[model samples]
Target: MNNKLHGPLFLAILSTLMAFASLSTDIYLPAMPIMANELQGDIELTVTGFLIGFALAQLVWGPISDTLGRRLPLFIGMVMFIIGSVGCALSTDIQQMVFWRVFQAFGACTGPMLARAMIRDSYTRTRAAQMLSTLLFIMAIAPIIGPLAGGQIIRVTSWHAIFWLLVVIGGLMFFSLFALPETLLPENRVKISLANVFRNYSMLLCNREFMRYTLCLTFFYVAAYAFMTGSPFVYISFYGVDPQYYGWLFALNILGVMAMSLVNRRLVLRYPLENLLKVAVTVATIATLTLALVVKLQLGGIVAVVVTIFLFFSMNGVIAATSTTAALDAVPSSLAGSASALIGSLQYGSGIISSLFLALFRDGTPWTMSWIMVIFTLSSITVLLRRGPLPENRSSLN
Candidate 1:
């Protein structure tokens, strides 16, 4: 990597790009009810639409980035994102909102997907892990800030302002992105073709070590997104938490993420990544189980819900950085884009499932959220422990 592109500013730009997905979703979450009442249809459509676009678009962006190099595909995606954001801000009905949300996500997915490839292009395994941790640490700030700022914005203005705010963010980040050097060298680039894309992805799908980590990471994301999809309604409508105060509670969970990210950054130096991952998974399982127990027994009220959710969400700090690094490390450098796309596509794709689960089984309580989290957490743990390649055997397996 160029020295000019390996400083704080470089990390900031990459992290900001990565934050686009979370920023676009979290900022409008507090105002979802307002949007729903005014728009007169299922507001969950916005979330589901974004998740679908985010999930599927990465497949295209990843291959295109690999072929064309990262910068061109990235700039094009940002332009799409900007146009979509403007459309969202001007939407007159739920149908239009859903369309633009999907469009916005099509562009938004490029940021994180390509950012991961860029990181892989720059560093080896351990260094990549550390840099990813640091990237996540910076990126975590968006979730902390988004809902808080969103809550205040909705108090005085319509939810349209929220999309406008996203437009401004997209514009600024689009310009800031120019400073990032193209990490994928020309000599390393591959040709873009449907057959080529299919073959590369097929190769990744058959790699046991790669699939294990990717699947585990995808499960964790599903669990967390399930919570995100349902929490606003659970907290505000069910528990009567004020919308303005929702972000404060949300920040607590994200703070847990930042704290755990820092811890993972240090622990990676002294501990095997597998060990760190195991412990994180165990802790996450326990937290979700406890949350289920709390919500079932009604022992902790909202206090218990927040604390347990905090613990469950905090493990994201370790799980996301470590699992992603591990999965990417299992593949040849040429496959980084496809690996990232596969991982991202599945992770976000599961959100649609989570959203549908809540939509169908929800009973106006927190039970559906808790159940989905538990199911996915258990699925992740099972994959990591029972199916994942053993540490000593990973080299041969990959």
Candidate 2:
């Protein structure tokens, strides 16, 4: 049965699942202003709640998927996503919307966390790395498609339409999983106990190499979250770009990231993935620092800021895809779910930090986001490139 989960079919399942997870955020982003008024909540707070839900959900779901096997947990996830989406549509207040959003995020998170675990289940380290990139490359299309479609959805209907679309997507994924075979074997399964879950996570936390890649991935991820959280207001309010045009600008950065992922898909087999990741981290650091300087100097206006941002985001595909590959590859196969979940939890934890930072320090200028990106990118570089020979984690693919 697992053999059937081998090729394009498997990629499609994971990408579709990931697409929905991504859609849960990307699609809803453009509608934030309308939502602020109708749902009666602060835009930043709503976004923060949803992202926090999205990240925190993985902590529990990952271990559950590990304990129960992928199928039951994933099935439960899809159902919850549907319910959450539906509940969100019916919400009359912002609080209700936030609650439903948290629920939806929990369900939506199953996609990426389990997708990584499933890849580990069936593929070797290098192949798993390549597969993850390919999955992300496919998932990358969602950001382009989501915001564009979301903008159109908003023009035609209300923000509630976004949730309704999510409901339909959730339904399709739930039914689609019928064909997804259980990838985790009985021997690999662990007991579903609280102590066991903590132990599983604590082991990954203790592993220096595993923490290296995971934290690096998480820190680098904060820049992306900050951009998403802050860009709407920056573009719409500060730059005075039309809401419709904002998605295109957003899509431009997303397309750059996608292009890099495609490049990684080609190079991943030929180069040592870790080396590629290091190079990516280095490039991202420089790009971010340059962006920060540009903001500090107040040079080139919004166009310059956007250009630097695109460059900064372009590294996302190369760094993130490669780092995730390295992180999971470094872990023992048995702890893949736990490792993936912790990675996700930290990833979103940084997202929470990014949101709070934006809320606290934003002064109607892009300087704050620029410095924040620089800070996070530097953190990743420091984690991954400390002043010693890097510890050998996985055997070299090249």
Candidate 3:
């Protein structure tokens, strides 16, 4: 069944599955202020709650997928996602919205977590990096479209319509899986047990190469997630940009992502992915530092902030794809699901921290956002540099 699937269709399915997280998170962002006002609660809690659920649920899904094969767990997850979206649509207050968002994430996390494992199931290390970059290139369109659609929906109807739209997306994906072949073979299945789950996860944590690569990407992602959480306030609230036009500025960053992912597809053929990862992180750190300074000094107002933020985000094209590919490559094939989950868990976990920072430092300015981005990008670079050199040839865990 897997053999019969065409490449482009297969990529589209996986990309949409992975893009589910972004689509879920970004679509309601344009309505944050209005939602907060009407619901009499902070809308940011919904994002934090979703991240918390998204982070922890991946641990359960990853190992379950390894045991049960990919398709069954995904079917279960999509149903949960659809139900959660409906719950969100019907929520009467921010607390209810947050609760349902968390529930929605329980199902949504399965998409990207399994998507990475599925990619690993099909490709070798270098090929996986290239394929993931291409997948990201396609998936990047979600953020570009999400907020635009959200803003329009709000203008005509209510923020509740956004969740209704997500319900439709979840339903389509649930049906789409019928065509997706189960990638995990019977021969590759591991027995489900508490002891085995702990052992496999322990082995991954003890692998220095895996941890280094994982943390490098994870820290860099803190910056990106920070941008996602903070940008609406910075652009629309602080700078007084109209809510409808907010999507245009947001689209600029995603266009940079698409451009860099396109460049990465070509560059991977000529350069080692590890080297590319290092260079991308360094460039991202520099851009973030400049952004911090620009916002602190009020250097060029919103133009400087947007340009620098665009440059910083563009590096995600290379950093995210290569780092995941390299980290999963450090482990055995059977651990791919668990490895993907741990990577995702750590990445989304940082969002909780980002949300907290914004809340604690709620200054009605971009200061907190800019600094958080800089600090995390620097942390990623520090992790990458302090690790020193790697062996030209390394052994994977047995």
**lDDT top scorer:** 1
Residue 179 accuracy (lDDT) in model 2: 80
RMSD of each: 2.3, 2.3, 2.0
- Model 1 regions lying over 4 Å from their true place: 192-194, 387-398
Over 206-323, each residue of candidate 1 has an lDDT whose tens digit, in order, gives 9999889889889988899889989999999899999989999998999999999998889988988888898999999999999999999988799999999999999999999989
lDDT values for all models: 0.89, 0.81, 0.88
- Tell me how candidate 2 scores on lDDT: 0.81
Report the lDDT tens digits of candidate 2 across residue range 1-398.
45577657778988887676567888877888778887776767766777788888888888777778888888888898899999988888988888888888888888878888888787777677677778878888888888888888898888888889989888988888988878888888775685677678778888887788888888998987888888888888888887777889999998888889889888878988778888888888898888888778988878887898898888888887777777887777778888888887787667788888998998998877878888999999999886343345455321
Q: After superposition, how far is residue 67 of candidate 3 from its true place, in Å?
A: 0.8
Which structure is stronger by lDDT: 2 or 3? 3
> Which run of 10 residues does model 3 get worst, by summed lDDT?
389-398
Instruction: Give the candidates in order of lDDT, highest first.
Output: 1, 3, 2
Q: What ranges in model 2 sit over 4 Å off?
A: 191-194, 387-398
Model 1 Cα displacement at 226 (Å)?
Answer: 1.1
